[model samples]
Target: MVTVNLGMLHYVIDHVYGAFMHRTKISPPFFSRGWGGSKLELLERLINQLFPDVEGQIWPPNLIQPMWKTVWESKNACLREGVFRTPCDEQLLNALPPESHYARVAFLTPKFVSPQNMACVVHLAGTGDHTFERRLRLGGPLLKENIATMVLESPFYGQRRPVLQRGAKLLCVSDLLLLGRATIEEARSLLHWLDSEAGFGKMGVCGLSMGQYILLLLLHF
Candidate 1:
């Protein structure tokens, strides 16, 4: 006969409970909101796309034409607000709606005074973001220091978010990835544009929350 001592009894109890028990059920766990089979398949595809072969040197994106559009002009600091746009990868574009205002960076820079060395910051925004609505206080000291600050309209942000979508809500999984791809590319495009622009003495990128997160990914690609 199998001998079950106190320690063995405890082990058996743990095994049985572990299979069908939660230590705490106060809040739903990660991925607890089960995505259906179709979404799961998309999740799989997303995984594959994200996890590319970990071999070979990372290649830079090809030259893309940047379309600049002025949205706001700040008299406080001679801020000339403009949008920086670059054509996204054709494949990525296919995923987005035709009218989708994707891959654009809203910027603020000094107009009258041209700095011999343009020190720029690629500032980013958080949720519920509107034009110049980011938490970061763009004007004042930085402008005084002659540091030009620009903000990239993140995926599903400002003009980039589809008009039909209405409000900023959690986008579908595919849309999320689509946003991510566009975002990384947009950051790359911005950097490329800065590099091409003449009189680019020094450039810096800064952000909060989502912005901060992308910087990590930006350097990797």
Candidate 2:
């Protein structure tokens, strides 16, 4: 008789699935462009300047106010889709690919709840998560708790993905760093909007996998 470890089997299955899905010939491997020379240098300089041997020293000097354009609304007005320009600083903005300049967001809330009576949580993306649909569905059940979900479409995925890049595989190593920095800036701005402009009583940020790492970095500020 052969005994198989269920956990190990499960891990093997996951890896096999991921390999087929993400490592195919049609799907380019990440960092195909190698370590981007100038871009990597710029990022390193920025990091050193921001940190300077001090913990939690990095923070956005100003949050750009989002000018939202509504894309859609549920008939009951509980779900809405909107987009705004990414609130990254000029230096970071110039570094980003053109398509990633704008950010898309989806809001899911319980109808008839006042902003002060409800809470909103901004959801960040895991690796390769390209759309708001998955996050929206995950958040939908929380409506019963009067918690609203704000799903952010990350740069380098969905409509923001660079044209030359294949699927979620970034073209350069520096692009990964760029994506994280841009996401933090955008998320901070969105949280500011929720607190100051929308007047939500309570707010939070959450993410999965890579997004969780980004959330940890966001906490530094």
Q: Which candidate wins on TM-score? A: 2
Q: Compared with the true structure, what per-residue lDDT tens digits does model 1 show for residues 1-221?
A: 87769998999999877655466553334333344226577678765664355363254555455556555567645444454443565666766655454455555566666646557777765555645644336544677677777677766666666665545553455665566666767666666666665355677776666667766766667
Q: After superposition, how far is residue 76 of candidate 1 from its true place, in Å?
A: 7.4
Per-prediction TM-score to the true structure, in the order listed:
0.68, 0.83
lDDT of 2: 0.83
Candidate 1: which stretches are off by over 4 Å? 1-39, 50-60, 69-76, 83-86, 99-101, 111-116, 164-166
Number of clashes recorded per candidate: 0, 0
The per-model lDDT (C-alpha) reads 0.60, 0.83
Error (Å) of candidate 2 at residue 188 is 0.6
Candidate 1, run of 10 with poorest lDDT:
28-37
lDDT of 2 by residue, 1-221 (tens): 99999999999999998889686755667898887666767657866643344354445334555545555566444777778888776777888899999988888888788989999999999998998888988898888898999999899999999999888889987788888888987888888888877889899999999899999988876
Model 2 CA deviation exceeding 4 Å by range: 1-13, 17-26, 38-43, 49-77
Alpha-carbon deviation at 103 in model 1, angstroms: 3.3
